[model samples]
Target: MDNMFRLMGSEEFSDRRRCIWVNGPVIIGAGPSGLATAACLHEQGVPFVVLERADCIASLWQRRTYDRIKLHLPKNVCQLPKMPFPENYPEYPTKRQFIDYLESYANRFDISPQFNECVQSARYDEVSGLWRIKTTTTSSIAGSEMEYICRWLVVATGENAERVVPEIDGLTTKFEGEVIHSCEYKSGEKYRGKSVLVVGCGNSGMEVSLDLANHNANPSMVVRSSVHVLPREIFGKATFEISMMLMKWLPLWLVDKLLLILAWLILGNLTKYGVKRPNMGPMELKVVTGKTPVLDIGAIEKIKSGDVDVVPGIKRFYRNHVEFVDGQRLNLDAVVLATGYRSNVPSWLQENDLFSKNGFPKSAFPNAWKGKSGLYAAGFTRKGLAGASADAVDIAQDIGNVWREDSKIHKMRSRVVYRRCISLA
Candidate 1:
């Protein structure tokens, strides 16, 4: 891998082709997908330099996520290639453990990405067959705007780039107390002993509420809808094992019903605490179809124990008071919104009409853009917590296959790219 990077890095680049350093392929986002893709590319003799927007690797882990977060997937299945967590680590690593694992992975793979440099825009130059990438950051030794011209561009930026704060009516104008997005959440110490409202029941929501409960914060979870909340460890085995064993054969509807029934039998209505299990089927197919298991986080248990209060969705907020859809109102100290995130592709591409109708850059696999430019996207979709690991495997496999094919045709093509410029401008 080192030999490959050295070889590619030494290649002579055109000075006229100013964009990237013209070292090798350019990768955006130094999160899990970026690191994994870099590892595979290194092993396969592909040279790439990763551009990160944060001050360190795994910024999401170190910055965005809350304390006490744990991987829902078991450690074994979620392990990365060529790098595994130490045996002494927990079966399901905590947020800190995960950060250590990623840091170790980056070190082992020799992925010294330039930190604090955020990519602003990237465009493919058809005439030069190079990708022109621009950035806004102080880290670049070359000064303000750095450029890179490369044959390929790989976007390893995962889906969790931008937090999805909902545009609630009167939220900005009326609300008073501390209102923060999930991405800004660091700990629950501030909410301790205070009435807190946590919106969203996804893994983040569950974990946050539990943390607040553990801290005796008296937090209340606002569940807007129904979701399948499964035990992380079921019957001394990972719930994914059960899901794989049972969910595959049974129809989705049946599986949803069965899981709900089982949860009800074990956990009860959950409504008294304010959580309502859907009567029909799973709200999202992503949960029902995939074997990704949701952690219960004992939020229901917290509610049952009266540590955490479960409440309906927020109807409105006035000063330090909150109104719910149930026509109930309460005064709260803080509101932590666990609302999800949107995939933020760099600006250059966004302005060029590159994304699909769904906002994802159009590509089938590892490659995000299915054009002759060889631009690919590594991870722009959220599969789960283990999504980083899962996506790494798939992207590595695809990049390997694509690189092999490109290598074979490398010598057959003309050295210079001559493209007739068409005026779309």
Candidate 2:
């Protein structure tokens, strides 16, 4: 790799093009997917550099999530390749605990990432068969710039890079109350004794409403569309674990049917609690559309008990109240938009063909890790951490194969050149 770059003469390469060369792959984002990819590459004896925009690893888990957040999936399923959560951890670890676990995992493997370095842009140089990456470090006041060239580029930035706050009519100027997205929400202490309207009914929306209710806030949720709400546990075990076990033996249709029946028996009729259930089953929805089902913790109980009220989607916002689509209005002190996020992969990705019309990876699971023009996407899987780990393994294997083949070809070409030179001498 060094020799290939050295072969470029001064006439062909300018001083600006002589960037810091990284012989191996360059992994972006130091979250779960990035770290997992690094670990896999290390195991294959492949040297790589990890670049993190934040000051620490797992910035999403460390900063973006709310204080009371916890992993919806069980610890076993969420564990990385060889590192498992502490034995003493709860079935579902809290956000802080999960962040600690990530930190420990990175430290245990000696996976040191370049922190505070945000990737500004990456362009593939066809002539050199490498990726030219421009980055800006956040540590300095002037934002020092740096460049690097690598053979392969791995984009491990997860799905939730940018917050998606739905636009509401009259929300900007008419509403005088506080407005926030779920990403900015920490706790409900500031909302105490206030009538808060939480938009969207996903997992975060449900949990945040419950947190507000518990903290003395009169909370109401906006059920914009149909959603599948499931109990966190069934009988004596986690519902996710039960579903996984059933999936192993039963077909998808039958598994969905059984899970639906179980959910109906445990949670009773969601319609009775003003929560509208989608026509599709939870498992089916996840498999078909990749939409996450809201895993109920204590939110359903609160809703049924009249602590958290349910309302239709918002029509518009008023000076001191919000008008619902059903022609009803409620006086609210604040509005929390738990509308979720969109993938920011297109922001810095020069190759537009690598993304779909919706800006998501064009490829599906198992194949999503590989993209066009020597690009790879990680952590975009529907199965979350488990899917990401699997994708990392596939990516590492593919990269290793390509690298080996390229090395062999380069060696053959070098031998041919040497023989020709000896004959000329």
Candidate 3:
């Protein structure tokens, strides 16, 4: 208790007369992006602290996955800057292994986080030009609260925390079977011989279906639209390894289109297998609309082999049956919604109108907005989960530049236009 209070509220002076302030200059989540951001800050000798709602870093990955869950991208591309993963691990690290990696990462950087500290509210104080952060410590703290007046706020809380379950009609009154979101999912052992409907075809949904099949569960996947499917490996190398190499040389749009074309050529007429080719241009973070394609998990093979069933989207639900949009009803013993998540930021920041109506922060750059006092948003956009690493690289330089009071920040004030491109087609 005494140490925790001292770390957050008290300060010590360094030899160079550098005032190592106790107040947090940055508060980051303990996820991948958050860890990368903190690592960069530490390297720069920045005074910051990370607040994790869970007992450790990567808690979401620890809690919100079925058994046998593996990383969609390979370790070479997913790793934080300068931290090489262990050679013994597979190309795609499993959930437990990844959690262990995050632990190793924090320890390697000597980032001793204030575990079990969940940030409840974060507000910007205009008069003091700092962010007033409020957080509740875990049971060990006996409900004692802590406050921080930080110079900046980095939201590494990815968009995957709040699950987006479908609003089925009469679900509460009619359905008698168990319904669970992917977040609460742990394993498929209980449904060893029962029938189940796994909704959504994203990475999580496909992975869940695969696990159920392995456990002898008759899992039917419900696909609402089409997805671009790519293999984990091509020509004896991980796909993401190829992607990271290409992303450095080519533009994002060009890379996406080229990859999409390559996937179609390799996979062929995806519609026959319930996968759809997007009618839009290359999938980029800038075009933050509609669903992206799925990474192939051999689940489609399970579907063809009669181990899993592919059905249309859900329209309604009865006691143990789910009706699809095509007027087809199927009997199911359990339902697993693999739908994605949304950002659920606390009210303290939301009340400031810092976020766009779509719930994302309005500006995203060195100077995203005009005349807003010392508030920053990093790791908000998703360009694959490793986007956090990308954000860390950009943000560290940006923040360091800001703290140094560099003249370059003023050069882009009139030239940069951080406007959203509206799609009419």
Model 1 alpha-carbon drift over 4 Å, by segment: 1-18, 140-143, 247-251, 279-284, 287-293, 346-354, 361-372, 385-425
After superposition, the stretches of candidate 3 with alpha carbons farther than 4 Å from their true spots are 1-21, 138-142, 241-261, 281-291, 351-354, 363-372, 401-425
Clashes (backbone N, CA, C under 3 Å), per candidate, total 9, 0, 2
TM, every model: 0.83, 0.92, 0.81
Which clashing pairs does model 3 show? Answer: 226-276, 228-293
Best-performing candidate as measured by TM-score: 2
Q: How close is candidate 3 to the true structure, as a TM-score?
A: 0.81
Worst 10 residues of 1 by lDDT: 416-425
Models ranked on lDDT: 2, 1, 3
**Residue range 1-425, candidate 1, lDDT tens digits:** 34333323543433334434445677788888888878877777767788898889988888998777777777876676667789999888998898899899898888998777777788765445557777777666865756665666777777777888987755678888888998888778877798988888888888888888888787888788776676666567876656666776986677666666666777777666666655545423554333223468577688788887778877888877888888999888888888877677644464344466544655433344333456666665445435455555655566677777877776444332222223332
State the displacement of the C-alpha of residue 175, model 1, in Å, after optimal TM-score superposition.
2.4
List model 2 lDDT by residue over 169-224, tens digit each: 97988999999999899999999999999998999999999999999999999887
